[model samples]
Target chain A: MIIQREAVLLFAGLAVVLAVATAIGWTLKRFLAEGAPHPTIDNLNARINAWWVMVVVIGLGAALGRTALVVLFALVSFFALREFLTLAPTRRGDHLALSFAFFFVLPVQYYLVAIEWYGLFAIFVPVYVFLALPILAALRSDITRFLERTAVVQWGVMISVYCISHVPALLMLQIPRYEGRSLLLVLFLLAVVQASDVLQYVCGKLFGRRKVAPQLSPSKTLAGLVGGAASAIALGAALGRLTPFGVVGAAGIAAVIVAMGFLGGLVMSAIKRDLGVKDWGAMIEGHGGMLDRLDSVCFAAPVFFHLTRYFYT
Target chain B: MRLLPQLLGKAVTGLMRLLTGAQARWVGCGPAPTQRIYFANHTSHGDFVLIWTCLPPSLRAMTRPVAGADYWLAGGLRRYLITNVLNGVLIDRDKATRTRDPIEVILAALGEGWSLIVFPEGTRNVGAELLPFRSGIYHVARQRPEVELVPVWIDNLNRVLPKGDVLPVPLLCSATFGTPTRLREGEGKDAFLARLCRAILALRPA
Candidate 1:
């Protein structure tokens, strides 16, 4: 009974999001017909199209139950980690460490989450993989930039795999009353984070004047941050029944996610600047790559997971 | 039987893309079915495979990698891959006297309307720097003057799978194909080789 109710809710929610996206896309198309189409508008349309596909995939995964959902997110983690490590400069000495990170560490991390092995999942990458990767590099005997190379690969695994895994790990939360509806928590987190991102982009395009960090991210603006966060907070409050958090609690948590999401984009932008690449990869049409789409989720996942685990569960 | 090689090609292609995240950029000229020599920098064992897999499927069928006879023919899986899967042109790199001219073998492959992928450095370098050309490229160009010589600069391959590494790290690599060059009349061997080297080097990402 609970599963049927959840499935209906998931589909209905997806339909609403899709309808809104189509309307926005239609309006943008009409607007684009009027003028010499702006690059930002084209990019906006592309992102909206990508969002429709993402929503369909997620909705389908949610309908299929836990295993599919976990597998879907695991694939996302794989792509995100691939994007992250591709840009970061790693030497030959780090090859074994990286092979292990991709082949061994990432899968193991996701497996732990799937099996609900919380203790190992939390520290596998951070503690064991982190120490082991440097030692692997050291074994190659290439001491030049040893510490820097090791740290970069370790950080990539931590952020892309370990942190992103927590998003799906929401499914395993053993809340007293929550029971089978834990997937709702995952949906709530994704909804708030992605909503914040989209709203921020829309706001920035319309009212952006003062850049937040010109050096790091020219697209980010103070106006967009405030307006987007406020809108997302309202949205989260409105959808509060979906999660264990009530209206006020949901709003507060949404604000935290928004702030972290903003910071996540900034930090990733900084890393891109350091690497001297505009986008992470060219996989997602106009959205850059998987990492670009998930930067916020990567940062917010662990925080939201821990918060929900502590407070609600 | 035919399906096996096709599946193997695709699997190898997928693996190369997954491991290196290789992006193929035809900067100067778009991919065409014309006979051409894709000369690139050799950095790892995976260099030829990376370049080979990056080609469009239509072009990939007609292209063969020029590999070292000593290494690719060492037997077992390497031999099977080079002979059956890739249809690679193996040349003796060490014994210039005992073996037939590697250039003749490549030229014969070219004569059959097949394109060839050659590493002008002749050997893989451990560092990022491009090693000096080994005269094989110049000789090929002189013989097949009409054949386009496309310079491909493969970046980050050294770091992905350097010398003596059995496994490859999943790193982003790119193969930038520059404007095709040909051997000029009255050009000295040294001068032509230098020019060819410069063309490949120019395609490196800033």
Candidate 2:
């Protein structure tokens, strides 16, 4: 796949925005927050730095063509699943099934995506993996909390591998007239979701008072939702060129992405609360884990992919 | 000449770190470069590998894991991996066919300026509670009173690659090093082993 002109423009625009963010973070730290214990500013800088690393990684993957991007997301699913199952109650009985999930299910799902086998990749995890793993676990006959254990394993593969795999699966869509530009659809989804996250965090700090759900996620607030989601929707409209969707369509889709991404974070937070962990795993700085960073993407990607395929393709 | 073994050493350590996070928490003491014995609970065969990978590379070269000869010497590949790649010390479990005393061989490794990773639990404990510790740790510590015994708790490795599982699931695992204790001058064998056992179990993640 040749380097599309639109993709290059999108990348350059993202790089400029990241550079500006880095400049702001450095200025705030070097002058305003110097010699003082400012956790928020430090955390903001750390988050910006992590974003730099992530952009570089995704850029490199896109540069290498279709196979590289699929492989990269395969690794992403692998790490995210590892973090999810770490806090889960997987006993000795679940070993075989768990190994199969890691070794067999993960790579094959991504392989199907890479080859653009829409039929197999679509139902592979939801149909095949969902049914097989429980049988494997039941073979060991460890009947203590059997249903709960198998359900957690199913939920883990669904969220981590099946859901997250849809990001790369976006590349396989053959949208008419938007040929060779489905990569931009990926860019749009990521931009809207991540922008919503950063905006929500900033809005929460500035004007948030009433906690949205103090039980599940303490940091989320009503003001953050309205302020952040509204801004991200506008950002999506501005990024309308990337998607086949025009300005209004872009904003409408961005609204869907924001709502799904918000609920996705809450669902993951509930799982963390149930498991009694502050973070999924300490894989990234300022970000809790691979799953923590990808939780919103995990929910947004599948919905965005299906929407694009059903209407646009 | 030595390049192949050295490369193999780094590769094995890298793979172990990748499979298990092999994250080292220096809770009690820093990973200071010193000739000390690290005694931990026996659960997975990967126990010592995790601990070995947790150590600083400068220390990893001089650290040797004490593995059972029956397991490590079972095949030609196992022999090559244990002796060449991992730099492990294979101790005989059966006394009938053994010529040299296992304790004496361990002491000889110490004399060669090598720190050892010993499992005091003798065998893998499939259950939640720790098994009764073997007396080898007491004897090794008693003879080398100068060596500090650092109790390491290997968390989640057993779950990472449990018994009879061929492949390890990529789970986050940690090896926590605790405060070093030494065998006192008048400490009895049972008392010394019991103390070390408690020290190891104390570092279990709450």
The segments of candidate 1 whose C-alpha lies over 4 angstroms from its true place after superposition are A1-38, B96-99
True contacts kept of 2: 1.00
**Model 2: residues >4 Å from true position, as ranges?**
A1-3, A32-38
Worst 10 residues of 2 chain A by lDDT: A1-10
Model 2 scores a C-alpha lDDT of 0.90
Quality class of the docking in candidate 2, CAPRI style: high
The TM-score obtained for chain B by all candidates, in the order given, is 0.96, 0.97
By lDDT, the best candidate is 2
lDDT of 1 by residue, B40-96 (tens): 998888888888878999999999999998988897988988888998988888774
Query: Mind giving the per-residue lDDT tens digits that candidate 2 earns over A1-313?
Result: 3337777777898899999999999899989998476898888888899999999898888878888888999999988998998889989999999999999999899989988999999999889999999999999999999999999999999999999999999999998888887778877888899999989988988899999999999999999988999999999999987788889899999999999999999999999999999899878778879998988899999999999889888
C-alpha RMSD over true interface residues, model 2: 0.5
- Every model: Cα RMSD to truth: 2.2, 1.8
- Each candidate structure's TM-score, on Cα atoms with residue i matched to residue i, is 0.94, 0.96
Model 1 chain A — which ten-residue stretch has the worst lDDT? A32-41
Pairs that collide, model 2: none
